[model samples]
Target: MRATEHWPVVVIGGGQAGLAMSHELKERAVSHVIFEKNRIAHSWRTQRWDAFCLVTPNWQCRLPGHHYPGKEPHGFMPKDEIVSYIEDYAKKIDAPVREGVAVKKLSRNGSGYRVETQEGTVTADQVVLAVSAYHKPKIPALANDLSASIKQIHSSEYRNPGQLPEGAVMVVGSGQSGCQIAEDLHLAGRKVHLVVGSAPRCPRVYRGRDAVDWLDDLGQYDLPVDKHPLKDGVRGKANHYLTGRDGGRDIDLRRFALEGMILHGRLLGLEDGRLVFGDDLTKNLDAADAVYNGICTMIDKHIESQGIEAPGQAHYRPVWQPEIGAESFDSVQAGITSIVWATGFTSDWSWVDLPVFENNYPKHERGITPEPGLYVVGLPWLYTWGSGRFVGVGRDAAYIADHVADVSREKTAVPVASRKETRPWHGLDGYNLASAVA
Candidate 1:
């Protein structure tokens, strides 16, 4: 007979989402156990580059009741500082977490769930799948075609430029990771070529305030999917390209051009012996500028509506270079020694035994999986723009905890007929569907 330890609730991940969920559960006086596949906030520990800091200001590092109490509110928090914050939060809250317990299986067992891990099995009435968005690094398929002599490392494996071979580095995918790695390599005295996509960019500080503050005040972070007028645009591209370096500084690709770094649009594919790029360099650059200018315009309106006196904001544009084509380059002719693929990541739901995902992503209104007694947190747009970020995830976590409390208080057992035939109930992200749902 398999030994079964029972928990009222079992939280799957130990990252920011999981920790925040655990904090809420403890506050509600709910009984639960947290299973962390590795140490707390493992991604922050292992995934980020050595010099990486959060793009969001320190004040936006809000999770539940915890706020950045540090003196530097406008400053960006570094990787180690984030890890330390997670560690301290776990300690202070006494988050009931089991480190190094990788959940091997999560499947429906009767009306609840049976979670099997390397350590043992846990039977819980509900499961909060707190796995974050990024686990695996997404290197392009074209990477395999690169010369074997050219060392290639995904941004996740990169610690510093010294870890790479001596020569110019070609950084691919101009998303957050791509841009940062390119900046890092350039600053390290290596020749850098940045291959950008249609990723958006914004100035770090606008109108004497951090760009995030402007977005935050304009409700960009809190708007719902339908309420957002630019749903197509929001869903079209990845998050805006900006950096948190040097106490919130703007990271424009054009500036990189001025500093002698070559820039390209999107990487097409490998030709005979070179890399082909698309002709959308100017198009992509324009998209980035639109995002920056759009936000500034919104901020300007907000200031006017409230009759608030604000300093005049300076306008910035990318400097065109006659020396650079601002386009394609053959890898060999470009003297590219290595390639850093900073595209993004793909989600792995193989460990889950239920069919709750669409396109490898958990399909739910928000965080809800059709299954009852189930919940998810920390997914992009799971609840709001801030769902995946630490700033507002605590709110979603609390919502889940409330639903769990309600479910636990009920004396009636869910009839086998009405329950989702496939899985169980996950704390859905939208309106407290629990009242109508329960």
Candidate 2:
């Protein structure tokens, strides 16, 4: 077999973005191969724990022409359901996906890209990096001080409360994951302890509506990350907290905390098999509340400026804000058998050899990177507010495909290997549909 096989494009990471890209390429009659490090929806299968559901509602989860199936399209779906949807998407569109093949290295070869994977090497005129931003977990160093008697797990390893010990549990990080996990454990009849930290809180519901409904009415979903002025200022500062019906009527964290969940100060350290925490639990919670209040203020301003009208302003209760720096955080040394770190994730692209990433982020105009034909998806902020990840990538995928087509038309030569000649099952219609948004 020759070292260089012809393909117009090769996409890395077979997750949502990669699949979407392939669908687009097909429409353009572009010959391409997708290299998935693991099986399709691998992250959904491994990283997310049991009882996990999509934060984005069902209708929003749809990609391009495919809408997530079944009724209640507005409700959240389980992780397994999402994984199945992705697999079905590949099968339905007949996407070219190489399962269990991890791309180890990538480099510029002449005017194209050389992708080295466990299966073999392929040289293509273009490459798309579709790996997600939350590829690695951040485990606190303080967790090491605890003796072997207690279990220590990063949020990535956590599935449900059943994974923890029977006694009191310490949930670190007050972000959405931390809050959700703490709530789950308490509901499972486990004595829970939440180590509070700095974050913005948003009510689970407003009056009789889900928070998502409010976001839709306010055009929050329409805000682009790159173009929006407010997203740039408070991009990753927000956290989800339910206060009313959705927050409490059915499932209440505050009530859970009142009954069994002991709110603790930030987990500072561990000494002699005992946990030591900051004495500022009250202050931290208060600060968290302040962050949330600031977000509501901004949203209100946006609603006014956009001249958007929402239904039932009376039901729109005041956004929940934790009292800043007002209370203290306490720690209990007994019955606490394990510590689950629910802190957020950090990116790991060390395996990706590229000079195009600025401060480890791709330097791209829209979705097109500096490297000719190189693209990235599922980034923290690729284009708009959530451009490269979640339900937002639909627009980003279209933007990239359109740019690729335009660039190709401008080029004189068809590169070393053309997709039309190499791949037998090729079509340009799907690619056109995906890129049509441009």
> Could you tell me how far off, in angstroms, the CA of residue 335 lies in candidate 1 after the best superposition?
1.5
Once fitted onto the true fold, the runs of candidate 2 whose alpha carbons sit more than 4 angstroms away are 228-253, 271-274, 290-332, 411-438
Best candidate (score: TM-score): 1
Residues 395-418 of candidate 1 have per-residue lDDT tens digits of: 778777777776877756444344
Model 1: residue 106 alpha-carbon error in angstroms: 0.9
Weakest 10 consecutive residues, lDDT, candidate 1?
429-438
- Count backbone overlaps in model 1: 7
**Highest lDDT scorer:** 1
Number of residue pairs clashing in candidate 2, backbone atoms closer than 3 angstroms, sequence gap of 3 or more or interchain:
23
| lDDT for position 309 in model 1 | 81
Residue 124 of model 1, lDDT score: 90
What TM-score would every model get versus the actual structure? 0.90, 0.81
Candidate 1, residue 418: how far the Cα is off, in Å = 22
Per-model tally of clashing residue pairs? 7, 23
